[model samples]
Structure formats: C-alpha cells, structure tokens
Target: AIRCTPPDALRALTRRQVDTAELYYIRGDVEKACELAAAAWPEPAGAEPPVRRRALALYTHTLLYTQGPAAAQKLVDDTLAQAADDPWLRSLALAFAADFNSAGDRPYARRIAVEAIKICDELGDRADPIAAAVAPMALAEIDMFGGRGLDRSLIERARAAQSGQSWIPFIDRAEVHLGLSAKHVDDLGTSQAILTRTLRQAQDVGESSAMLILQAHLAYTELLSGRPEAARAALAAFDAAAREAGPGIGEPGSLTVSRALLAIMDDDLDRAEAILLAALERLPPIPIVRVVMDTPLGAIALLRGDVERAITLLAGVLEQARAVHVNEPSVRGRPEGDLGQALVTAGRLTEAAGVADELAEIGARLERPTLTGIALRVRGLIATARGELDEAEKLLGAAAQAHAASPMPVERGRSLLALGQVQRRRKAKTEARRTLQEALDCFTAHGHRPLARLAEAELARGQRAGAGSVLTASEQRVADLVADGFTNREVAARLSMSVRTVESHVASVFRKLQVRSRTELAARFKQ
Candidate 1:
C-alpha cells in the first residue's frame, strides 16, 4: 500500500517539492510556491545532476517573477554554472540573465536573450516544450520596449502550450502578458477584457498574489483610458491585495510606480517626482519598472521649463530606450516625440533635426502615421529654421495630411503654422497671409492660445508687409532692426518681443523686401 506522506517527506523520495512548487506557482500561491521552491534546494541535492539542475532552474525562476530580476541576478550565473550540459536549464538561466541585465545594460541583456532563444530553438519540443514556450515570452518582453514589432504568434504559442494540461502550467501567464502587451500596442479593449478575465480566474482560485499583479495592470489600463478614478480604485485594490499576499510579483513597488504615473497624468509633478525617486531607491532595477518611472519624471522636468534638466533626463532616457529597444515597441513613440519637442523648446533645432530624422525613420518602420506625421512636422520646422523653404513646404504639407488622418487637431494646426512660416520666409505674401490666417483659426479652435498668439503674430507680419501697406509702428521698428543686420535674438531684446515674435517680424521684413535671410535683407537695404 502506498503511504500518504507530507509534501516535504515526498520531496525526499521524489522530485515532489519542485513539482509541487511548480503547481503552487501556476495556481498563483506565490509565497507558498517560493518557499517550497527555496526548499527544493538543500536540494534533492542527493538527486542526479539533472534533477538538481531542474530544481535550481525552478527556484531561480520563482525568484525572478516574485522579486524582480535584480533579486535573481546572482542565482542566474550559479544555476548556469551547475546546469551547463542541460540546454533547457541553461536556456532558463539565460532568460533570467537577460531580465537581470535589462535594468542597466540593455545591449548586453539582448545578447543574453538572443542566446537563450537560440538554445530553445535548437531544443524545441525535444527537451521540454514548457521551457521552449518561455523563450518567446522573453523575446516579447524585449521587443515590446524597443518599439519593435511584437509578433502576436509568439503570444499565441505561449497560450497554446497550457492547453490539455490539467494543471494549467506557467500560471496561464500568456493571457496576462498578452494583456500587458495590448496596453503597449494601444489596444486597451483587448487588454481590459483579457486582464479582467485573468482577474476573475485568480479570484475564483483565491490567488490574491496574482490578483495584485492583475489589479495593477487593470489600473494602468484605466489610466490609459483616461479614467483616473477607476485607475485609483484598481490601485487601491492592488495595494489591499499586496497587503494580504505579502508582496508578490509586481507588488509594492509597482503600486508606487502606478501612483506616480497617476500623479503625472494629474499634473502633480512634485508628487510624481517624490514617489518615483523613492520607488527607484527601494525597488529592484527591473527594466520595465525603471523606464516606467523615468519617462514621466523626465517629462515633468520638461513641463517645468527646466530645459537643461529636461534634456539631461530625457536624452539619457531616450538613449537607454533605444539601447533596450525591444522591450515595448508600441509605447515608444510618445517619449521619442517628447524628447524631440523638448529640444525644439530649448531652441536646439539642429539637435532636434537629428532626433526628428530618427523618429521619422522609426515611425515609417512602425507604419504608424501619427508618429510619422509628428516626425515630419518637426523636420519641417527644422528646415524652416535653416531657411530650407522648399523642403519645409513638402514636409509640412505631408505632415498636415497625416495629422488630419490622425484627427489630432493641435498637431495639424502646428503643421499649418509651420507651413505658413515657410511661405512667409519664401516671400509669397499672398499665400503666407492666407496660410497664417488659417493657422491662427486652427489654433484658436483648439484652445492652444500661445501657439495661436504666435499664429496671430505671423498674420500681423503678413498684413504689415509691402511698401503700399500701412505698418504697425511696432512692425516698422522690427523691420528696420532686421534691415540693420540685427539677429532675431537681438531684435527681440531691443523691441521687448519674444524671439518667436521677432522671427515673425523678420520673416515679414524679408517678404516685404522680396528677400530671403537676414543677410539678404541687410544687403538689399545697404545697396
């Protein structure tokens, strides 16, 4: 007769601890699983090397999900060292290695992940399909951040692996991960539906640990949908779940990060900054977590008009973002656009032009017209600044069409204003006058008063142009300063006008003289 033994006693006779830990994990009994996994060590150390390797792989895997990659960093190397001949174990080791490196060194992290996938591909269906299935999830994690295309087939394969299995291995994580991916890809409905289902399942199983993760995700989804109160409610649930479950995967720190994001959306930059800084201090440097916290912090610096600080924050963020480009491809556009615009705001148009060129390439590759249009608009503005009117006109006209398709009125208006500025610079006063007027109207309709005021100034410049037209006394003074070889900055200081206003006046002076640059205006008047 078979004797019924406790799980730990059964562990001595078989690989039961590791096996049961796997069940506990899949069922979302996270703390219980982790404890059992940690005990799987000491190990069935008396077991054959392969069994020991499997135990180590399972233990490290549990740590990775629960405590973040940094928490598992040391174990990755130890597991691989001991499991050298087992391709499945080594592949798992490599995946955790990638996750660990994701925080600070992206390129290195990707190399490790590629090697892991390679091993899995070679071992596909031969060693362990369960292990093979995880490779794609690893790739998806990397690809999602880089704005690279995330092949849904990878996710589909992961989901398929759980079928016909009574235990529903890997915690049915594919659904939740896919839900997270949807959030990245701007498919909020799919995300919500999938996550809500996962949440219900976790609830049915009484897996409060998984509930914390699912709730945090739900909060993020609500935040993206612009339902802040719903997001807050979800976060509150996540916090409550964490309190109950003892900080499972994506807990405590993820809660803090979510709160910071909500504060940012509410325009409470100070609170966002404080929360982010504290989280960064306390949390493990997981790549996804780091980027989530930093992106908004940088944006806040930009919004505060701390141009240098914004550049410092955003430029570093963008650099790391590119290096780790495969993490979340769907969520990359806004940060890229923000950095480019911050450069423009700082009057770093030359640098902004380079950034715009890269963004345009990325946008085109992604086939995302909105990002493409924004990139084109930035390029057009840069060309206008450089006196490249023909190129500016082409870029801005294309941008306007793209933004109209996007239905983003403010962006379209900005493009129109840029096109008008180009026309004004090219001395096409009739076209410039009409175009500038249209831009003013667009900006006014959008409640973007500052840009509207800029558009108005452009219109005033067009109206004050020509020998036959009556000049505003202010226009007359700006025109004389430009004709006397003063740069827009100098004219701005002399006339108490903003530099942008001075640019408009100077463009008017050029149109009135039928000249191009300030040099041309100086030459014409001197001659």
Candidate 2:
C-alpha cells in the first residue's frame, strides 16, 4: 500500500508504515518490525512531527534488540540534535540513555537521563506521558549500576504514570525495575513473584524483548533465592528465546552472572571463570558486573587454595567497589568479606583485622542483616586465626543468628562452619559435631558443593575427636609425620594408607592442634 501511494501522499503512507511496524513489534516479529520502523524513518523534513518522532522511537528501540545499542546511536543523536525540546524526543532520549547504560557508558547515560528529566520538568503538564515515565526510571537504573541504592519511589511513580496511560509494555517495564529493586533489598520472595507475573504478562502479549529481559532478571533472582534449578530453567528459556529471536539479541549482564553462579554451584570453577572472563571481554566495563564477576573468580581461587591469586583478584574487586559511593552488601560487602578471608588464609592477620573492622562498620551503619552477618563471619575468622577460640565461637554463633533472618542460606552455612571449627578447637566435641552437621545440611540442601565439602571435612575432624583424645590413633600417627614435615602423599606411603585417608587425617590434626600451617603444627608439637 505504501509503495503504491502517490509521491505526494508518501508522508501519510510512512506514518501508516510505523503503525504497522508497531503491530509487528507487539506480535514478537522483531525483525519485520525493525525493518518497517527503519523504512518509516528519514521522513521528509516537512513531514508531521508526531509521525517522525514515533518512527524514530520505534526504530531505535527495535534496533537495540536486533543489532545492539551501537546500531541505534547515530539515529538517537541525529534526532535529538534537531528536536531537543520535543516531548516525545525527550522520552526517546531517556530510552536511549538506558541503551547506553546497557552498553556500559554509564556517565554518558547518566548525563542524558538527567537532562531528559529536567526537560520533562519544564514540559510539566505538556510532557509526553512516556517521557515523563521513563526519565526517572532511566536515572534510577544508572544510579543502581553506580552502586547507589535504588530509588524505588522513582519506579513506583513511573508505574503509576504508565498505568494511567494504559500501556501494558510500559507498565511491564516499570514492574521489572520494581522487581529488581526488591531483589536488591533482599526481598527474594517479592522479587520472584513480581518478575514471574510480569514475565507471564509479557509472554501473553508476545512482547519478545520484554520477555527476554524479564527472564534474565528472574533467573538471577532465583539464583539468589537459593533455587539454582529454577534459575537454570529460566536461563535456558532465555537462551532459547534469544536464539529464536536471532543472532543480534545479546545476553544481558544479569544472565551472564546467573550462568556463572550456576556453574559455581555445580563446583565447576573452570566453567565459572570462563563465563566471567568472556563477559568481561564482550560486555562493557560496567562496575557492578566487574565486581560480581571478579568476586566469584577470587572465591574460586580461594577454593582452589591459591591464596595469592585470590587476594590479588579480590583486592582489585574491593577497590573498584569502594570507588562507588553506595554500600550495597552484595556489591561491596561480599568482596570485602572475601578479601578478608583470603588475607586470613595467607596469614596476614593484621590486614584481615583491618578488613573486618571496615566491614563491621559498614554493616553497623547500614543495619542490613546480610552485611552484618558477613562482617561477623569475617571477624570470627580473624579471631580463629589469632587463636581466640572462645571469641571466635561467640562471633560465629552471632553471625549465624544474624543470617537466620536473611534469605541467604549459604552465608548462614558459612557462619556455622566457622562456629563448628571454633568449637572443635575449644574441645566442645558434641557441639562441634552438631554445628558441623547443621552446616553440612545447609550446604547440601542449597547445592553449594564446595562449601559442603568444607563442612564434610570439619565433620570428619569432629569424628576423629571422639571420646577423650582430640585425635584418633591413626590421626595421631599422621600428625606426627606432618609435624616432621612429611607431605600427605609421603605420609600415606610410609603408613601404607591411601592418600585420601592421610589427607583427611592431616586436616583433622591441624584443626585439633589449632594451627594454621605445618610450621605452626611443628612448633606446637615441640612445645
């Protein structure tokens, strides 16, 4: 119909093309939608402003999903240059800011978002409803990536405004933000409920882009809520959708992190590291992504007993996180705790103590249970290193209590592990067994294999500490050889025992002796 129209009637025909493109977009035919939207654009200079603006907005938005943010950059820049004061153009600017954000140009994104908000304020009653709704949402998103706490009121206001407009897609966008905010505040249940319901709505309308984004968010929320199986299913669905949508539909940062975490849960450190490294290469230098990815990488190093590498990775992550102003527990606090643990493992007690102090201060100031619990766990580890067994026990027990009200079972399990170890050191055999059992149960239930192994090792030590002696006869023989500087394999050869049994006995001996290293064990034996 458009091609058959007379040359003089092309302007109206172009507008009709944009309307048809919007219908295509609504029906999830994104490639067809984008082609039509792009064709409707570059309208004649004398064309209707509303028609041009609508075409530009649809074209840029659809292009983001079809060809990524870079493809839309020129159009957004050229449109804004000509109509900086246009309300619909201002709204388009807000949407473009969000694209820049996802592309990792946070400062530029923030500037555009703030300017759009100011323009919306000036337009007041005359402002486009979409612009009015998106301006605050865009700014809030930037702030969140900057490590600033989410301004949930902005999301609420956007939702209220969008609701009045009766635009289902716009309302779904607001709900996505709200769901993410809930996740940030540790409200896992609320986050899951909102994302799940909104995702269903998006699917119902064939809102393909919205559905993909929501699925990514839901995957991460499920991971955080200790539902790795659910997270895996959601992420798989997201990947399937993106594949069907074609090559240019890229994975979101949240989905990348979720995949890495699932790998970590499966005890596949190599796979997790590979996932994170790939993300760093392909994704923009988004600070939150860096923090999240590197922290886990550091933890994998620590799990592998590469103390120096863990410290290096974790220290850099913490420094990057500190540059951001907000004290978001998951971003800053988790890295702090990880770095502290690495420092302690390296026998850098003084530096570990300093990290503990800073973490405790942040936890106290924020009054968040997760942060407080992490701080206490770190402090407890430091105390154990210093051989303050009773203090370590108290701190770790308190840390477990702090995490009890929180949804993160993994953290609570960590506290219990520390408490159990401290109890073993203090000769509280029954208590140690009970605490270690609970820690093992928590880790096993949550599918945290690496942590569960640590609990198992602790339980093994507790069993050897049965009856009167802290070590069994076999463990005593292993400790004697270890104190004489014999390696596990060497000791196993001498004792005619398997290397695995020798290793287990060696670990039990170290815990029973309250020593951090072989040298410390040698000294204790000499005394």
Best by lDDT: 2
Separate clash counts for every candidate = 13, 0
What does candidate 1's lDDT look like per residue over 201-301, in tens digits? 88777766567777877887776554667888898877676666654555555467668767765657788899989888877665555666677677676
For candidate 1, the per-residue lDDT at 208 reads 67
lDDT of 2: 0.74
**What is the per-residue lDDT of model 2 for residues 85-187, given as tens digits with 9 covering 90 to 100?**
5666756666665545643666777777777767767777766666667767877776765556578888877776677663435323677777866777667
lDDT (CA) per prediction: 0.66, 0.74
TM-score of each: 0.68, 0.81
Quote the lDDT for 513 in model 2: 69
